[model samples]
Every structure is written in structure tokens, then in C-alpha cells.
Target: MIGLTTYLERAQTGVWDLPAAFLPHAYFDAVVRAGGIAVLLPPQAVDDRVADRVLDTLDGLIVTGGKDVDPARYGAPAHPETDEPRRDRDAWEDALLRRAIDRELPFLGICRGAQVLNVALGGSLHQHLPELVGDRRYQLGGGAYSSAAVAVTPDTLLADVLEATPSLDVPVYHHQAIDRVADGLVVTATTADGVIEAVELPTVPFGIAVQWHPEVDSNDLRLFAALVDEAARYSAEHTARHSSRTRHPEPAR
Candidate 1:
């Protein structure tokens, strides 16, 4: 089954509430549209051992969009524009993502989730795009989504899945962007102002992160479909591995 990690939104009391965990419809819609069963993973149960256990059972990982990541994660000073930081959630997801990477599990990160993936992999963020990029129309009107056009790199995984030229209009609602890209990751897409829009780890099985919210775009089914197909393949492989070990026990290793 495909498992997607859900981030916890902090309340005023600074307590991580499990019941408060929720994800946008676009996330579920994308997963469902891709023919994968969407399983919501709790942020509270995301320690290293637990993450490893979860990864052992799952086929793919989807890190959904949420609030800004704590700057301390990427070795940066806190930006004044930063909002309520979910430290616990950060720790949990980081461990989960690390385990996923070690297992080479297919991962799809969106918006803040993309930032988290970058930071987890030794990268930094801009914190506030307006201050860093200057007069950019990142946050769309009505606090909804980004209407910016992202230029996709040719000969990239995302480009292959999208099947579009180089550029495509995407929805953006983030004020932060990837500054220093993570090691083993390549910039696959960007905005006109040079904002990092998408990143892909070429060596990995299927690791991709996008600064935009493709979930919010109903027309963007190809992206999610690709992820789901990968997940299905992973599931088949995992099941076969387990069955082989069970049926033909290795001779007294």
C-alpha cells in the first residue's frame, strides 16, 4: 500500500495533537487519481525505528504541503516572516524521509514538503521569497494558489511525466524556496525569476520534489499517475521479496 506522511499543525498551546492532523483534498485526489490507495501516516509515530518499520511495509511516500520548516533544521537563523514551526513534526518526518531514502522508496514532495525534503538532505531555504527574490508574485490572490509559470528542464523525470515543452503554468502558495540544493539532487524546474520549482534525485529510484501544489491542479494527473505507478511496482517487488524469503528460506545463513 502507498503511505503518505501527514504533518501536524500546531495549536496555540504548543502541543502536537494527533486528531488535528489533516491534509488537503488535492493530496488525496492526486493519489486516488493515480490508482494508489492513499494511506495517511501519523506524525506522532515517526521515530527512526517506527519510520523504518513503516517504510518496510509501504511502497511509496508522499510528503504533503504544510507550514514553514524550522530554520534550525537547515542551519539557518529564523526568519521574521516564519510562522508557527512544528518541531516535533519536523523531527518525525525527517526520520521517516531518511529511512525512505535509505530504502530507495519512491517519494513525492509538494510545497512545504519539498522544502522539508531539501532541508533533510543538507539544503537551505530562502525563508521569505519577497525579501530574497524581490517583488515576485508568489502568493496568489485570496491566499489560494500560485499562478506562476515554471520552466521544466528537458530530459528530466518530471518533464517525461508531464510531456509538456519546457514551461507550464503551476499553482504556487509558498514564500520560501530552495536556496542551496541538496546533494545528489538536480534542479528540474524553475520560475522566470530563477526560483527553484522542482528537484529530482536522478540516481534514486523515484525522488522528486516540487515547490508548487500540483494536487491543487485537477488537470495535473500525470504527475500523480506516475507516482502511483511507481508505488504499484514497488508493492509488487516488496511482496515478492517477502514471499521468496518465506517460501524458500535461505539455507542457514
Candidate 2:
């Protein structure tokens, strides 16, 4: 099963108000097309045990994009444009990400998810792109997507999955970006402006994070397919181990 993170939204589910765990259908649809069962994992208490329990059940994890990671996390002063951090999500995803790394679960992080992955691994973000880039070329307008021409770095997981495409058109939507990449991550793709569009961990068989919402494209299922393939292998191995343990019970002293 592939576990996906969700956002809390308020709605009138009843006579009164209510906050519901909400996730975009695109995430679920992408996972389904990639040959994996999708499960929505709402944020729980900031406990290691809780995080581990959730991570243990899933073969892979996809941290969806959302509000900015708390600036306090990386000890950076929040820029005027930076939105206030969602404390609940920060606590939950922080624990979830740390545990996922510990467990080595196949991880695919989206835009903000990509940022969270970087921060979780001791990296940082640019916070605001317009000031750094001097223009809004990457972002077109609100509720719309800008197209970016991406250059994939060879000898990386991204190129391997996309078959070394010299250039590819991808939907872009983000102001914050990876500033200092994490320790084990290698840059796999970028735009002409050199913004980090995709990254992967050399330590894992399938640990990838992309700034573009690959899940947004119905045709480009390569990224999700790669993750699902890795997740399937993980699930099979996990099931085999469980069966072996059950068959050969440990002797009590």
C-alpha cells in the first residue's frame, strides 16, 4: 500500500463546522495508475512510535505539497511573503519523514514535500524565489501552471527513469526552492535557470523528490511507476519475512 499525506480542511459536513482530512484526487489517481493501493494517512501525535507504526504499514510514502515548512525548523528568519507554518503538519510530517528515512521506505516528495524532505535531511530553502531570480518566470499566475523546460542530469535515477531525455516540458508552480541540498541527495534535473527541479538519494533504491507535480500529468506516469515498482518489491519482501517469521516461531526460554 502507498500512504499519502493529507491536509486538514474545514467544511460543513454536519449542522456544525468540521475539519476534515483532505487530499487531492490526483494523488490517489496517480498511485492507482502506478499499480499501488492508496491510503490517506492523517497526521497523528508527534510521537516516534506513532510515526513508526504508520510507516511500518506502508510499502511507500508520498508527502504531498502544501504550506511552507516552519522557518524555525532550519533557523531562518521568515521572509515577509512566507506564509505562517502549519504547526500540525510540521510536527506530523517531520516525524513521518524522519521515520521514513530510518525505515528506508520508498519515498516520493512533491513540491513542498520536496522542501520538507530537504529540511528533514539538514538542508534549507530559498524561502522566496522572485527576489533571488529577479523575476517570476517560473510562476505564471495564481491557480495556473507555468511550463518549464527541464534538463535532466545523466547517471541519476531521474534520467534512468525518463530514459535520459535531453529536455522535457513540465508544469512549474512554486516560489520556494531547495537552497542547500541535503547530504545524500544528488541533483537529477533542473531548469535553464538552474533551479533544482528533482533530487534523489544515492543511498536508496528509490528515493526521489521533484519540484514539479509529476502526478499532475496523467500521461507522465514514469515517476510514480518507478516508485510503485520499488514499493511492490518492498511489499513482497516484507510479506515474505512475515510469513517466514510466522512459520518459524521463536522458541521461548
Candidate 3:
């Protein structure tokens, strides 16, 4: 099963208007299309123990796109363009990510999810990309996606998964980018402007994240398919190990 993080935001539906734990259908849709079961992980009070409990239930984890991560996480003051702190979500995702990393869980990050991975691993964010890039090319506003030509690094997991030529035009809609990349992450993709577009944890079986919204591009399921394939392998190994333990319990003193 693929555990996908979600946005805990206020919503309005028939005869009701209240805070809800929901996610865009597009994310789960992509997971299902890639041949995996989708499980929603809404923001909640979390500790390492709680996070591990959640992770123990799934074979893969996905940190989906959403509001900007709080700058305070990386010892930086908030930028004028930064969104107000989503403390609950931030804490929840951080704990889960750290635990996921420890367990080497197969995972993927999208947009803000990528930023979280960086910060959780002693990295920082640019806060306002337009301010640094001198234009809003990454974010065109009005909930519309702008395209970016990202060059994928050769001989990297990202390149292997994408099987891309040299570069790919991807849908992007973010105002921030990785500033000081985390120590253990390998930069796997970048744009013409030198913006970090993707990173992967080389130590893990399958840990990759992209600044672009892969879910938005319905035609390209390469990334999702790669994740699902790894998740299936992980699940199979995990199940076999558990069965072996169950079938042959250690002798009691």
C-alpha cells in the first residue's frame, strides 16, 4: 500500500463547512493508475512512535504538494511570500519522514514535499523563488501550471526511472526551491536557471522527490510506476520476513 500525506484544511461541501482531512484525487488517482493501493495520511499530532506505527502499516510513503514549510525549521526568518506556518502538518510530516528514512521506506515527494525532505535532513529553502530568479516563471498564479525544462542528471535513479533523453518539460507551480541541499541527498535534476528540480536518497531502495507536480501530467506515469514497483518489492520482502518469524518463534527461556 502507498501511504500519501494530505492537507488538513477547511472545506465546504453539501450542508457542511468545516476543517477536513482530505487530499486531491489526482494524487491517489496516480497511485491507483500505477497499480498500488492509495492510503490517505492526514495531519495529526505525531511523535516518532506514532509515526513509526503509521509507517509500519504501509510499504511506501508519499509526501504530497501543499503549503510552504515553515522557515523556522531551518533557522531562517520567514520570507514575506511564505505561507503561515502549518505547525501540525509540519510536525506530522517531519516525524513521519525521519522515521521513513530510518526504515528505508520506498517513498516519493512532490513540490512542498521535496522541501520537507530537505529541511528534515538539515537543509534549507529559498523561500521566494521569484525574488531570487527575478521572475515568476515557476509560478504563473491563478492555479495554472508553468512549464520548466529540467535537465536530469545522467546515471541517476531519476534518469533511470524517467528514461528521459536529456531534459524534460515538466509542470511546475511553486515559489520556493531548495537552497542548501541536505548532506545525504544527491541532486538528480535541475533547470536551466540552476534550480534544483529533483533529489534522491542514494542509500534507500527507492527514495526520490521532484519539484514538479508529476500528478498533474496524466500522460507520464513513469515516476509513479517506478515507486509502485519498488513498493511491491518491499511489501513482498516484509511479508516474507514476518511470515518466517511467525512460523518459527524464538524459544522462550
Candidate 4:
């Protein structure tokens, strides 16, 4: 099963307005198309034990994009443009991700998910891309996506999945970028302007994240497919390990 993080936001339908835990269907749709079961993981009361129990039920995890990760997470003052803090969601995802890494759960992160992974590992963000890049190219207003070409570093998981293409034009819509990369993470892709576009935890079986929104493109299932492939392997190995433990139980003193 592939567990996906979701947005906890207020919404309106018909004559009612209320808070909801939801995610764009595109994310789960992509997972299903890639031959995996999709599970929604909404923000909630969480601790290490709660997060571990959740991870125990899934073979893979996907940190979907939404809301700015409160800057207080990285010990920096919030920029005027930063979205108001979602303390619940931030704390929930942070707990889940830290434990997920410890368990080496096959995982993927998109857009804001990328930032969460970075900050979860002692990294910081630029906060406002327009200030650093002198333009709003990465985030066109009104829910529109802008395309930016990024160069992929050869010999990385992203390169292998993308077939070692020297560069690719990807759909992007974010105002923050990774500034100080965390330890145990490797830069895998970047735009010409040197903005971090992708990163991967080399120590894990599958821990890759892209600043671009691959889910935005209906035709591109390469990334999702790669994640599902790894998840399948992880599932098989997990089952075998469980079976072995069952067949040969350790003696109790």
C-alpha cells in the first residue's frame, strides 16, 4: 500500500463551509495507475508510536504538496509572503517523516513535500524565490503552472528512472527552495539558475523528492511507476521476513 499525505484546509461545498482533510485526486490516481493501492494520511494527533503504527500498515509513503512548512521549523523568521503556519500538519508530517526515514520506508515527496524532507533533516529554505531569482517564474499566480528545464545529475536514482536524460522541462509551482541541504541527502537535479529541483536520501531503498509536480502531467507515470516498483520489492521482502520469523520463533527465557 502507498500512503499519501494530505492537506487539512477549509473548503466550501453547496451551502456549507468547513475544515476538511483532502488531497487532489491526481496524487492517488497516479499511484493507482502505477499499480499500487493509495491511502490518505491526513494530519492528526501524532507521536513516534502513532507514526510507527501508521507506517507499519503501508509499504510506501508519498508526502504530497501543500502549504508552506512553518519557518519556525528551521529556526528562521517567516517571510511576509510565507503562508500562515499549519502547526498540526507540520508536526504530524515531521513526526511521520522522521520515523519513516528511520524505518527506510520507500517514499516520495513532491513540491512542498520536498521542503518538508529538507527541513526534517536539518536543512533550511530560501523562503521567497522571487527574492533570490528576481522573478516569479517558478510560481505563476492564479494556480497556473510554469515550466522550467532542469539538469539531472548522472548516476542518481532520478537519472536512472528518467532514463539518464541530460535535462528535462518540468512543471513547477513553488515559492520556496532548499537553501541549506541536510546531511545524508544528495542533490540530484537543478535548474540553470541553480535552484535545487530534486534530492534523494542515498542510504534508503527509495527516498526521492522533486520540486516539480509530476502529478500535474497525466501522461508522465515514470516517477510513480518507479516508486511502485520499489514498493513491490519492499513488500515482498517484508512478507518473507515476517514468514521466517513465524516459522522459526526465537526461544523465550
Q: Which candidate number would show the highest TM-score if scored against the true structure?
A: 4
Candidate 1 backbone overlaps, count: 1
lDDT (0 to 1) per candidate: 0.84, 0.87, 0.94, 0.94
Clash pairs detected, candidate 3: none
Worst 10 residues of 1 by lDDT: 10-19
What's the lDDT for residue 158 in model 3? Answer: 94
Worst lDDT 10-window in candidate 4 = 92-101
lDDT of 3 by residue, 14-118 (tens): 999999999989899999999999999999989999999999999899999999999999999998899999989999999988999899899999999999999
Roughly what TM-score does model 4 have, to 2 decimal places? 0.99
lDDT of 1 by residue, 71-186 (tens): 99888789898867888778878887888888889989888878988899899999899986776589754766658888999999988888856898988888889999988889
**After superposition, which runs of candidate 4 have C-alpha atoms over 4 Å from their true positions?**
none
How are the candidates ranked when ordered by TM-score, highest leading? 4, 3, 2, 1
**Model 2 regions more than 4 Å off:** 11-18
TM-score of 3: 0.98
lDDT of 4 by residue, 1-253 (tens): 9999999999888998999999999999999999999999999999999999999999999998999999999999999999999999989888888898898889999999999999999999999999989999999989999999999999999999999998999999999999999998999999999999999999998999999999989999999999999999999998999999999999998
Off by over 4 Å in 1: 10-19
TM-score of 2: 0.94
Deviation in Å, model 1, residue 194 alpha carbon = 0.5
